[model samples]
Structure formats: structure tokens, C-alpha cells
Target: MENIQCFRPTKAVIDLQAIRDNVVHLKNMLQPEVQIIAVVKANAYGHGDIEVARTAMEAGATILAVATPDEAVHMREYFPQVGILVLGATPISFVPYAAANDIMLAVFSQEWVEQAAKQNIDRSLKLHIKIDTGMGRIGVSTRDELQQLYDAITAASHMLVDGVFTHFATADEEDTKYFDKQVKMFKDFLQLLPKKPRLVHVANTATSLIKDASLQFDAVRYGISMYGLAPSPYVETILPFPLRPAFSLQTELVYVKKIKAGQSVGYGATYTAEEDCYVGTLPIGYADGMIRKLCGQNVLVDGKFAPIIGRICMDQCMILLPTAYNIGEKVTLIGTQQGVTISIDDWAGKLETINYEVPCIITNRVPRIYSN
Candidate 1:
């Protein structure tokens, strides 16, 4: 997959320097002793994982965290020495590979630990105990469960408890009541452990950015913010430093034509020209992750807003241009054009979703071009 070459005009431009700057800012904000776990899960939230991981490490991140065993293994192939942790549940079958590669697994259940220990592996598998303070996604819930899981891992000569962590459900919100409760529960669970692990991380991107420094503990997992995106609007307001967005969606107009009055553009004949106007077709559409809901959404053409007209097709979509633009004229979907910009947040607003989903939904059909 890495060797596949894409010759498409519609491509995602990734600024690696922005990723480096984000990591550097986060490193400066954390305590001197706190390690930064660069969460490069979901292909670095669709900015490309391996590249982001490398840039983040160069910028001071000490560990790379992914969501699945396959992602961790893929990263391990590129970075043999760097620590890679699987933040999600690992299949028992991956234990041998994880042990052999020195990858860490997030352990929450006694059953998973018992099954993992049965695998025939020559190396010790590093385990991170996950606590479910409130997210209810994964991890042990009660102090008893945490202590029992710790005991099982400690008893297994083939396994080592290297870290313990919890996810926050409200850390990105303005409200602190639920966030405070999760913190207290996590601390209480920590007290149950006979000996603390080398790492006791509890903060995600939101907590690391907006919460108190004490919550940072031994390390903080930097995720959404690592790509220069704030976890939420509330967190964005109180950011300790500015974030430089690293992703930009751009394409050139492939076809342009003038339509007379009453002529419609695109499928379903939804958009009919009331007067003579120009329409430009971009070489990207729903199949490229530009979903159809964005049909009336504004894109940048010649540094001005041009509304997407008609039903967004599978491979192409028409935009109502202010005038007839030459073929190959640049159109900005999620980036700056001249002095104007169409941000990811703007796309999120149009789609009624979060900013994180904007880039992630942009399919791999669009090649990601990295720029340092």
C-alpha cells in the first residue's frame, strides 16, 4: 500500500512541520518528567500515521500509541526500537507477535490476561492496565477488578505491567463535575495497586491541554491536539498555545462551462440556473469522502466562496462559480485561498459533525502529500 502511486489532482496536503510544532508545544506545556505518548491511531486521525509518528518523535514524543494490534505491528515494522502501545483491546492471538516485537497491550480483563499468558512466547509482553472511570468503552470498572488484573499480570513471568491509564468522557467539555468524578475514581483505583507501574497516564489531548498539571501523571496521551485540532470548542477557547492545522484539502477545477437560464447542473436537476452562470466540476465527489450532504456547502474559488450546486455525484460535483474559471484553476475545500480560508471546523459545521471526522472521512483515494 505504501508503494501505490496516486496521480489524482485532488489530494490532501499534510504539513509535517505543523505536527512537529504541535508536539513541541505540548512538550513545553507538560511537566519536565512527564512523557508524551503520541497517539497516532486511525492513521493519525487520517493525517497518515507513520509520518506523523516520525515527526512527533522528532518533536519530543517518547511513545507511539495506536488503536489496534495491526496498526501497532505496522508501526513496529518501521520503528523497531520506538515503543508502540496498542490503546485498544488486543486479540489473544497477537500476544506472541506483541511480545516478540516489544509492543505493549492494554489489558483490562482477567480473561484476556489469562488467555494471553497461555500463548507460546519467548519474550515478556508489556501490559497497560486500563481503568473504566466513566467512558464505559473498555477497561476494569471497580478497584477490585483493577487489583485482581494487576495480580494476574504480576504473577505471570511472561507479562509485565508497564503502565495504567483511563479515558475521560467529559475532559473536553466546559463542565468539570463529571471530569472531576472520573479523576477521583482513577486515583482510587490507582491506590489499589501494590506497586505502581512505570507509567500512570490518565490525560488525553483535552485533559493534557486544559486540565490541571497534576492529572498529567507519568505521561499524557496526545491525540487530536497533536494534529493541531482542539478536542472541542470549549477546549479551543482555553488552549495554552495556538495550534497550526496540518491538513489541507485542495483540487483543481477539471471542467468549466457557462449555463443559460433554466439549465441545471449535476444529478437530480436540483440546482437550476435562474440566470446565466458558470459551473465548474471538481474531480472529487462522494466516493472520495466528500459526502453528498455538503452539496450547498461553500468552497473557495479565486479566494471567494462558491456554493456547491446540485446533488454531489459519485465521482464529480459541480460548483457554481462566480464566473467562468479556466480549467485547472485551484479550488480550496479545507484550507486557505489567498487571504480566505475554509477550515475543517467549517466543514464539520456543514456536515453536523465534529472536526475530527472531517479529515478521517476523506478516503485514501485522495493521496496525502506530505510537506515539511
Candidate 2:
């Protein structure tokens, strides 16, 4: 086995400038008063949470959003003073933790309200209420039901309704009716409440792109678009500017050999050569988040497209390089060179999944190098 080189098919290049630039662009879209809740969840969509979070706040983010209380805790420990909100339900046991740290929680059920109230209310913890306008997920779902929770939270001196919001299921799709409906429901909640929250946000990245008024609150959570990735394929065609991909991945050619035609490669012998060609082995596979299903995918190498010619192994994969390619040549797994782009979109398309999950699944093992 080779003494695994550093560039061995397992590097994620994150562009800090792209992250900042995306925020600046989003800032341009918003009024001066509209604050941005930078969605740094899923390890900043696998761009490395702390790296992206610090960059986001430096670029005018007023708050940070995460999916779990644990993520909030991580943020609290890593980057203090930044407002962190757990955008989902939390158990009663963690209620004290949330209150203690002043980290906001999203309360959907009255049971959650009753539990939080049961806890000794010192000075009223900041809490955001999630309404299920149509996502069919964790949210109050109805104005009347929300009113009951609202009255209870209001009466409790220890729990202040800090914010009210909802999530959009298909805001990234071409249809806008569903998102508008959710917006109407959010507006209704605003009207129903005796006093509005200090922060009212429902619009995520896709909604922010299509609905200018969607950010009609103290803040809006900027997600995919904040990282310079398109909110959806549809938005790419209509967005005002070309968004640069903030992520790039690289893996260098480690071992290479010219295999004779008729030779099979890798576990299932998934690849059989048509002619004598060079094959480059990369020290990365499913364990590195490059799932076996992507074995047949194309990679940009030496200014040409090379195909992964074998079943991805535990920590190595084979790519059929062009005949002229030599050993030790660097390969671009996800990036642009000579005007050819191999982006997360390409990988997502190859895997029949969304771009969001593609980057998220990159996992934390791979080292992320930040740059301008």
C-alpha cells in the first residue's frame, strides 16, 4: 500500500470569499432593515460549520440557524455571542439547557409549551414558534391552535414568544402558490397575535429568491443560496447574477498503470477496457462519502473527462484516464478547469439526488481547506 499522500482523493475546498459574496448578494436583495439568519446547519451544508459560520457572521449575518440543540451547543461553544436557534422540537430535559444558554427553541406543540412553562421561568427564555402551514412537519399548523399556545406562552412570565415562522416544502419548485399560502398563514398568525415577536421569519433561500416580501420580518434564513449554490435548478435560469460554486473537490492520481484491453477492474469487474488505457487509483471510496454508486461517474482530469472504471472500494477507487495522461497528474473531482465544470450538480445528477444531500454526505472526515 502507498503511504497515502495528502491529496489522496479526499479534500473539500471551501471558498470563504464565495460564502461572503453570497451573503453580500443576498444583502443587496434585502432592505437595510431585513436581517439575515445564516443557516449554518449540517456543518454549514458540509462546508465545515465553524469555518462557514464565522465567515457568514463576518459578512453581515445577524443570526445563525441549526437543526438540533446539539448543533446549537456546538455553536455556543465554538462561536460565542452569536444568536443560535434550534429550528426544531426539543425535549423537556433540554429545555433547561436551551434556557440556560439563551439559545432559542422552536416550539410546535402545547406539550412543549407546558413543559417549558413548568420549568422555573427566570427572566423568560427566547422561544420561536414553528407553524406548519403546509410542510406537514413539526409546526402548530393552525391559527386557532397557535392562539392557544400563544396565550399560554404569553401568560407565562418565563417564556417569551421570541419568533414565529414556518417551513416551505416546495418553495424551490416552479409553483409559488404553496409558498404564498404559507406566507398568508404566517401573516395570519402575525395578525392573530396580541403582540408580534421581535423576530418573525419564514422565508428560506428559495422563498427569498422568488418572494421579495418573503423577508417581511426581522430576519430570513439564508441557506443554499448563501453558499453560492442555486436554491434550485429553476432559479439558476432566472437569478439576476451567475452564482459561483463555493465548493471544489480534488484528488490526485496516486497509482497508475496501463491495463490491457479485455482486463476487468475493481470488485464486480464493473469496468472492462475497450483498448489499452491508463487507470489511475484514488485512495477514496464510500467511507470517504464517495458511495459505491458513484463508481461509474466522470471526473475532470488533465483537461479531459475520465470515468471511474471500477466499483468504489473502502478506501480506493479506479478511474480510467485518457491514454495520453501520465502518472501523478492531479484530477478535479468537482470544480472548473478549461471552462469544463464538474460540480455538485453533476454529482447529484449522477446519483439522482439533490445537490443539498450530495455536499452534506461528504461528511466530516475529509479535510476542508478554506480560501478566498
Candidate 3:
């Protein structure tokens, strides 16, 4: 299980098979020639990158995309031949390492190419030109800037422009107004290119799943949906096939007690029992990525809801149990129990954030157990 020691009952379970299945489903949905670049950045969104990337390649992914050059270097240890694309902007100083490691970088400025070309490297530097259609992130904003970057990279003796892409800022949003605008601009930008690079990608998980598949130029960068969580509710409604969630958080009750009526629980006595009730303590807290704001949330015990009480401590939290339960009873924080289930979306709603942030914040203190 990836050498993840779990002396504590809390753990995150990752289903590698679900990841592979997601890749296969997306692959089947795309055209035969369109590749799938599995995004394994942020440690595969905190599901463990190496395991997820391997599963993706076995299931039909042709390339792996990460957020940083360090991530690309780490992935290279696991995969020597699989193409690795650094989706985020890389420092010019790191260009030599990327070239030596066979990592493709996302280049947006002529200066980066000029800086990279000066490096005394034997291997050719591969690059993916990023155009700022509407994301307002790190990308060339105009046709002139795009051409300049393209021409500069082409002029470089050791730099190879392997791909060109743009990110959609509103693809996951319900309204297609901005989404369509970005798409149109991306298409316009594609026309500006002298010729399409080896990879001409414009679609991400949201666009690929909900938007038109024809927009998938040469490949689709699959991230959140590949982890079995929908990019957005709108995308979930239109998914051509079902996605199996690959992550689950689980723990067990370490201590149990019955408190008298009017007795307060946790720090500052935030919650007071109206009547006598059984309270269960779990060995998991904000330190393990379960933030204190989740105090009023619920965890599953005996297939029933147990409302969390009081301020969540550094290494522990209290839950008002339906009744007295065994100290070793199982608890489901983000997974199925009997029939009921709590999803990352539920936690995202609690945090007022996206589901992608929910799993990614789960710290390394909690061991991640992997299974097929």
C-alpha cells in the first residue's frame, strides 16, 4: 500500500481500477487519434501520483501532465518513455533539467525560449505553447505574442514546439457564454499557427465530458473527472458514461462516552447536549486535513449520521452518536457505508469550495491505502 503506515485508524483508500476505468471511458469517447494526457499534478489530486499515472497509461493514456518541473522529474522516475508535459509555467533556469529529463514545458514567452536556447544541452527542449484565450493566466494574450513565441521556439536549434493549447476559464460553468468565447478564441488562435503542432489540445475534463468532442484537437487533458469526481454539476448531468470515484476517506471510533444532559462538548463548549447521548471520538482532525470549520458536519457510523460536535482539535474530533457504539466501530468520512454515502462534493459544499480542493487538502499524515 505504497509504504503508507497507518497506526491510526484514519486512512484514504484509492481505487486504482477506478482511475484506469475512467481513462478507458474517456478514451472510448474521444476520436481514435486523439490522445489522453492524464493530469497527475498535486500528487494526482492527492490520490498518490505514481499509482494513478501508472493506471492511466495502462488504461490508454498516452501522456502525463503535471503542474511543475519537479513533478515531471518525479514522474520520469516511474515512467521513462511516457511523455510528460509540465502544464504550469517553468522557470527558464529549469529548462536544462527539463530538456535532459525529456519533459515538455508550457512556454508562453519568447524570452523563455531565448533563455532556453542559450543552455548548453545535448537533448532537444520540447515545449507546448500556451495561449491566453480568456483564462488570464500565464499565456500569450494576442496573436502577435503567440507568433513571436512560436517563431522564437522554431528558430531555436534545440527547442521543439511539440504542442499548443489553451485553458478554458468557464468550461465548468453552466452558462456557455464565456465558455463559447474562449473556445472561439482558441480556434482563432489555432488558425494563427503556421501549422498545428504534434499536439493541438483545447479541451480539459469539463469540456471533454460536457462540451462538444469535436473541440478535442489532438488530445484532451483529463484531470478531476479522471478521479471519478465530476468537474461540475452540469458536466455530471451530461456524462456519456458513469464515473467511478477513486478516493475514499475512512476511520474508526477510538473512544466512546455518554454525557449527561446539559453537558457541553469540545472547546468553548460550542455544542451542549439537550439530553443524555453517546459521544464518539475519532483520531482525526484539522492536522490531518479535516479542518475545524467542519465541526457541525456529519460522519457515517453504523450507516447512520453522527453530527460532529464542538471545535475540532488538532488530532481529534467528537461526533454525537445515535447511541453507544463500540470503540472500534467503523466510520465513513467520505465514502459509502451500508447504502448511504458522503462525497467530496458534500465536503466542498461545507467548505464553500470546489470538490477538487477537498481531496487535495488531505495532508500526508493520513496514510493512503491503494487497491485495484
Give the lDDT ranking, best first.
Answer: 1, 3, 2
RMSD of each: 1.5, 3.1, 1.2
Q: Give the TM-score of candidate 1.
A: 0.98
Residue pairs with colliding backbones in model 1 are: none
> What 10-residue stretch in candidate 1 is worst by lDDT?
1-10
lDDT value for candidate 2? 0.83
lDDT of 1 by residue, 3-78 (tens): 2465778999999999999999999988989999999988899999888899999999999999999999889999
Q: Per-residue lDDT tens digits of candidate 2, residues 113-160?
A: 877788864655898988888899888877778988898788776788
Regions of candidate 3 where Cα sits further than 4 Å from its true position: 1-3
Query: What is the C-alpha local distance difference test score of each model?
Result: 0.92, 0.83, 0.91
TM-score of candidate 2 to 2 decimals: 0.95
Superposed model 1: Cα runs more than 4 Å off: 1-6
Number of clashing residue pairs, candidate 1? 0
**What global local distance difference test value does model 1 have?**
0.92
TM-score, structure 3 vs. true:
0.97
My TM-score estimates for the predictions, one after another, are 0.98, 0.95, 0.97
Question: Candidate 2: where is the Cα deviation over 4 Å?
Answer: 1-9, 324-326
Pick the winner on lDDT between candidates 1 and 2.
1
State the lDDT of candidate 3 residue by residue for 1-372, as single tens digits: 265666889999998999989989999889879999999999999999998998899999999999997898899998999999999988878878888888999999898788889888888888999999889888998989998999999898988889999999989888999989988888888888888789999899988887887988899999998999998887788888999999999999999999999999998998899999999999999999999988888899999999889999999999999989998999999989999999999999998899999989999888889998
